[model samples]
Target chain A: MKIALLASTTLDMLPSLADALARAHGLSLEWYVASFGQYEREVLDPASGARQFAPDVVLLSIDADTAARDAKSFRALASQALVSFPTATIFVHNLVLTAPDVLSLLEWNEPESNARMVAQLNLELSGVALGSDRLRVLDLDRVVRSLGIQAVCSPRFSYLGKIPFNKLGLQAIAGQLVTAINAYRGARRKVLVLDLDGTLWGGVLGEDGIEGLRLSNDGEGKAFYDFQQLLLKLWRSGILLTICSKNDEWLGLEAIRTLRFMVLHDEHFAAHRINWEPKATNIAELAEELQLGLDSFVFLDDSAEERALVRAALPEVLTPDLPKDPSEYPTFLMGLNCFETLKLSTEDRGRGALYVQERRRRYEAMGAVSLEEHLESLQTRVRIRAAHPSEFGRVAQLTQRTNQFNTTGIRRTVDELRSLADVDGWQVLVCEASDRFGDYGLVGSALVAQSADGPIVEGFLLSCRVLGRGVEEAFVAATESLVHPGRGVLLRFVSTNRNAVALKKLVELGFVLDEKTGLFGRVAPMELPKWIELETVSL
Target chain B: MPHDNIFPRIQACIVDSLKIEPGRVTQETRQEDLEEWDSIGHLTIVLSVEAEFDASFQMEDIPGMTSVAILTQHVEASGSV
Candidate 1:
């Protein structure tokens, strides 16, 4: 992706940022340094060859207040850039609140600078991001706070001392900028696998009973409760939630059921293995249940022992350390930008409900004596929908969270997915499953990227709750039928840490395994079983 | 532990702060003789000497703190016992 950066002031920190950007694998950046402090007609020329380079992404680091005051010129500059490079993803940074010394210059005695400045900055940022479908706004406030520095303050600038800006913090921000750029160019992780005990709650369920669990009421358990609520929100935002616990199953269930203080119900977790088994095994089971690969799973655990076990056992799992204190849980979890930094979509809001409905279906299937009886009793409904603006968010969320049944196990951001929806050869399908109990929201998602080989299943995933009821087979059959007619089309099942369960279906579909590579491939005539009804919508 | 030998110890501070080869730090060696002796590096020398000799150098003393001889004098005047 070709990127251009526009700065309003001298980027004293650009050297470090340039270094970081250089290290980024697939990005080519062309920096257009425009210092608002030294605005000149020659420097701001819109018709210059620099603007004609046609960047895929543009960063506007100019201060909002300054831009607003010189709106005509700034807008002209922005307009020229937009017109010259029509499809560029424009990013506008919010103005940082000045320090006390800087604020003291203003006439108002108010502790904070004029609300007008802050409001204008937010307004301009929103305007740009909303005005252009390709534009995005990076929250400078969040970035400043994450750096543990007051963004507005000069911090006693001394040329000899370390640079005024926090080096580590700026590096993180730069890294996120790079991630956002990559996501705009189509690269994002799909699933978030979380550890249960110290990560999700304030205390361990086995050690601290449900009554003793530190979850919020009004104040006492506020931090833990707030963190759970945040996770719930993330799940709804389309990040898949899986549990890998090394605890007694009954105890874990009792805590979720009996703990009045608990905020996350059984439904919040899409797939969980709460046995005393090593976390790696549980994580594997989770991946299998969710139909995701180990490569896509980001594991969070407070215990170093469990984290080490998973890190050693499954090297592909991205394990971010869980901060020791419960208070830092929310901040720590949110800092992991693997799934959070991407644009939010509608599919995300309905994700929690989908997972909940999936769990309800699983509960209903419990203790069914025969496979036929369970299949018949499921009363499952698979709703396939064409890619629509309304379903884009949930579709993006499903793309991110669905793992176990996933074919290639790739994830994409909503923006990227939307762009793909327009591409001629690609087919993006979302599968929402529900039973007699309720709506499963969006239980499955499939993406077929057309290639010379055939319509390759780039992603195939089903919510774990809907796993056992022939949903995987039914969904695959429907997907194949949609793409392949009369003739047999090849299906690829790439083995992953979690999708072992899908291995059976791969073989059952008559896919042959390469003795050396273990990559299963086969050609099978696609047929949806008569009992299952498949509904689909085309874009 | 002779109190008068603090001058040699101050020289040692210069050598460590400047990250120069021990023998390269001479009494007349200017700041340019050492590569790491930038503005921040100079402040580090003052801080290290102050800690080693239990003395404090004034802001004015910081600029004249170019070589080992000048730095040693500043340290001694500040009452390094």
Candidate 2:
């Protein structure tokens, strides 16, 4: 990735950022220095012959003190950058406000005062970027605060008595910048492995029982419930949910099934190995069951021992320390940034149900169940809707969050999805699933383009809930029926990390695998299976 | 206290500037530290502090005055905190 740095003043912290960026696998940096005074003419002018090369990422730096005055200028610069390079990711650095002159004006003698100011600036700057989808605001303040804490606590840095965070904080800030860049580039964790006992609920379910659990309608219990709701929301937003608990499996299942006020039911968890086993072993099993790379999992547990066990056993899995207090759970969870989704889709909201359904299939398979019997029992209804203005938001979200089941795993923003909808040759369709249990919401989406050979499936994805229900077959049938009449429509299923389940559907639909690309393609007339019912809505 | 009436004025400053309920802006309330105390809201707090106290703060002071206690102390020391 080619990054261009745009600072209102000379970036005194560029070397640190450059060093960190060099350590990153595929990152190159280029600097563009323009003062706040010359921002209007110099920064806005695209063909001014100043920026000779186009950059993939643009970093805009603003001073906290002057951010108010420079906010409009920065917005304009961002707008210009978007027009110049639509694909480039723009990051706005929270302003750094510190200096002896300014400190004297505030009339405080605290040595860490400057550091506090920088944190405040970054927080404020993040607010500015919240309105624009084209720009992502980096929380430079949090980065600095963590570094300050590290500097104070670390034995190596203890001798540097009261090191002002502003002077040497860039090193840590640069590391965070690289991480954020990588996250934006789609290099992030796929699964969030949660601990059951104190992490998910207030206490162990085995001990607390159904009504005894600390989950309620108000106060601290409410906070835990709210946190569970947030996790459920994240699960729908495409982060695979798994549980690693040291508990009686029967009691855990009973609590999940019987607890009335439980925000996260049994359906919320995709994979779990609830036993009195070491958390590391359970976590490894969960990863294997979900078929996700161990490195793409983030383990969250309130217990220090459990976290340490997972961290020691699987160093690749990110295990962030859970906050001591329950009140800090929201902030601590939000700070993970592991499952930072750039887009939300209709398919995402029903993803939890999909995973639960997939888990049920696995359970049935253990009983030596026939695939046909399971399909027949599903009573699955696949609703195909055209890309309308009302459904645009969810469609775009699905395009962003559908990674494993995604044909190309390419993410698209709302604006890009809108552009695709407007394009003449493209057809975007969203598939919603409803079964015996409940409505699974929008579970699948497909994007196809008119090609000379036939209508080609550009993008195809199904919510993991509707995975084993032969919904993918219905999706292909729906596409073939919509695009071509009385003719065979060619469909392509590209393999991805989480999409191996999808390959089964291609085989079921008579798609032959290509020897060279390993991608399955079929030029046969798509047949809507009798088990799957399709309802088409005009938008 | 020399600035007994200042607390209510500060509260009013926050209520009017931050566009929050007047009841929410007590002397104990922090500026951007509140859940709704976001970027534009933070700027409003800065402007409100400047207007209520009839004092101008350097760009550096904005970051330090996040909490209610800190802002009160700063205002008291400067004859406007």
Candidate 3:
């Protein structure tokens, strides 16, 4: 990844610091820091070093005074950068109010003052980010406030090298920019493993016995409640939450179930290993069960010993050090960028509920006498519909997140999904599943592009959550009937590190496989199992 | 020269920032002598020296502040650093 920094101030130390920061976070970014105060010229001119650099990410950084003087210029600069490097992700800085001008307190109170102007600039910049996905405001104002205004800015430094910010402050800005770039590049953690006692709530479940737990609406317990609310927000945004606690399962369940003030319930958790086992083992087991990598798991625990043990054993798993004080937990968790994501989709918002539904089905399946009775009892209904404009985001998410049952292993972006939907003779369908338990949102998608021979399945994938219930076969059957009618639909599967289930599903779906080409085709009417009760819907 | 307290620190800062040999950075060594001391590297050198000496460099002084001797003199003249 190449990163170009175009700033008004002489941030000489930023590039190396940004590279180091990016490298620390497992990103290899080549940095190009333009000369001081070259942002306007570089962005406006096509031959500037920024344009020549052809970076994957461009950081447009300027001080508050410069931005306030010309807010429209900043916006124009961002637009020009986008025009120059169309594919590049531009991160423009939102200016922070530092030293006061001659007006001082009067200016602070005045709406038309420099301070207000900067605030308006930031507000408009935020609107830009909201409107366009390619552009983002780095929120350097927040970064400066975090580092403290008096500490980050120095009059001597500002006059001396045209360097407006403190050394560490520049480093912090670069680090944050690197993080934003990485997030834009689609590097994100998928799962968060939380410890119950001391981490989620303020007491041990066994000793507290659900009643004695310190979870409350106010006081020290409020911190734990606040943290749970934050975790719930993250979970709702598609971050899978699992528990790895060293406590009795029944007691943990009791605490989760009985606590009135608890923000997270048992249903909120995707999986749990609430037993007296090493948390490392439990985390590994959870990772396996969820079919996610250890690198994608962030284990948050209040216990230093537990954090250290997981950090030592599974070094890939992120174990953020818990703050010494419980009150700081919410703020601490909020600051961790491990769970940052570029976009949120319908699949993401409904992820936790879908997992909960899966867990319920699993529990029911465990109790049933046989597999047939368990699946039959599920009363699963898969609704296949044409990909709507509202569904493109979830369709893209399914392509990115679903690995096990993803045919062709092709990850499509939201734009790609939208364009594919519009292509001539192409059909993109989203599979929505609901049963006696719950609605599994948009669980799968199939992308088929028409060719001379027939309609070729460019990509097809079903969420592993709905795998065993014959959703994949039903989807294939529906696709064949919709696309080819009487002729065979050409199915293609590309084997990936985690897509064996896709290949297996293709085989089971009656697609004759060519081992050499990894292509599957069915010339005959799709013969799906009678058990798969699928209903087709309109666009 | 040995008595001047800032010379060794300046030399160290130069060597560290430019990734050049310690001996390569002497009183006679210009910014052009080191391959890494391009325009971008010059800014890095000035900032690094400023950070090392706890002194700030004026924009007017930046062009002449390229060499080690000039940098050392600038820092020493600032006095407080």
DockQ of each: 0.09, 0.01, 0.34
Q: Is candidate 1 or candidate 2 better by lDDT?
A: 2
| Model 1: how far residue A301 lies from native, Å | 4.1
Each prediction's Cα lDDT score?
0.64, 0.65, 0.79
Residue ranges of candidate 3 with Cα displaced over 4 Å: A2-6, A10-13, A30-56, A75-88, A154-157, A208-212, A389-391, A408-412, A415-428, A449-455, A512-518, A535-539, B1-28, B35-40, B50-64, B69-81
Which TM-score value belongs to model 2? 0.63
- Please write out the lDDT profile of model 1 over residues B1-81, one tens digit for every residue: 343576568767777655677787766777888777876567556656755775655655567778877876676677756
* Model 2 chain A lowest lDDT segment of ten: A154-163
Error of 1 at A286 (Å): 2.6
| Residue A70 lDDT, candidate 2, scale 0-100 | 46
Per-residue lDDT tens digits of candidate 3, residues A126-211? 88778777677777888889889876776656775667776667777877887786676567788999988898888778876787
Ranking by lDDT: 3, 2, 1
Alpha-carbon deviation at A262 in model 2, angstroms? 8.5
Error of 2 at A526 (Å): 2.4
Which segments of model 1 are wrong by more than 4 Å? A12-51, A71-84, A99-114, A127-133, A145-172, A182-221, A240-247, A298-301, A383-386, A389-433, A440-526, A536-539, B1-81
Task: Give RMSD to native, each candidate.
Answer: 7.9, 15.6, 3.9
Q: Candidate 2's residue-wise lDDT over A211-321, tens digit each?
A: 777877787778778888888778877677887877888887887787766887776788887889888888888876775568878998899988888899999899999
